[model samples]
Target: MSKPPLIPFSTTLFVRDTCLCLHVQRAARALARRFDEALRPLDITNGQFSLLMSLNRPEPPSMSAVASLLAMDRTTLTAALKPLERRGLLETFVDAQDRRLRRLRLTETGERLLAEAVPIWKQTHAAIDAHLGEAASDRLRAELLALT
Candidate 1:
């Protein structure tokens, strides 16, 4: 009798079995692409949108605070703020009480941009909810947030 054929562990099998990371990454990319396309007229990326939203709270936040909120390190956050700062969307100033600290503020331009972007963001958000259905999407978002 012939021996039974053995299955080899190929890259494809490995990827298929352990590809949740890839699937999540691809989904994030797709979602970002959709948001980018939708926000193009406003000239904002999703990251920027998030940053702007973070700064839209009642009080101005410190650099470290904003970085913590965004789950980004100080260096990465600094780099990300460059374009927004250059565009007059945000400004960083030395803290009055703590000279060593830098505070992030949304300029008038930033506020205006965010106001314009809100409707675009709403449309993208609505489309996603519509595609996934409200309950499922909400539950998925809750799960994802929990993981984060």
Candidate 2:
């Protein structure tokens, strides 16, 4: 009986350097942290800011629609909405036309917070694009969208 071989540090380095998933995940976390810090005074995480922004529409979106757009499951979306609901930043209501569906709406406070966060998002996003090079950033965004 013999033990299996241990993974090598070189193999780990190879994956760290070449794995798209690892790189994307790391980049996502880094970007989230940067946006989170910029958005902290508004008391919202980056995810919450995106969630609230998705709700900024002439007509409120149904829970299903929001879940789809956020690429999250309904249960996860519901859980995410809880904090905002508690803070009175958003509300859920039974859809008027569709009795069974729940729709989400940003409260006045949510709109105000989102309005404030927009500038921070723009500045951070512009810096990211500028650092990446405008053409490269555009192409990267297109490539990423293709993945989705």
**In candidate 2, residue 122 scores what lDDT?**
97
Q: Which pairs in model 1 have colliding backbones?
A: none
Candidate 1 per-residue lDDT, tens place, 53-132, comes to 99998989999999999999999999999999999999999999989999999999999999999999998999999999
Q: After superposition, how far is residue 78 of candidate 1 from its true place, in Å?
A: 0.5
Number of the predicted model whose lDDT against the real structure is largest: 2
lDDT of 2 by residue, 100-148 (tens): 9999999998888889999999998999988999999899899999999
* Residue 122 in model 1: lDDT: 95
TM, every model: 0.90, 0.93
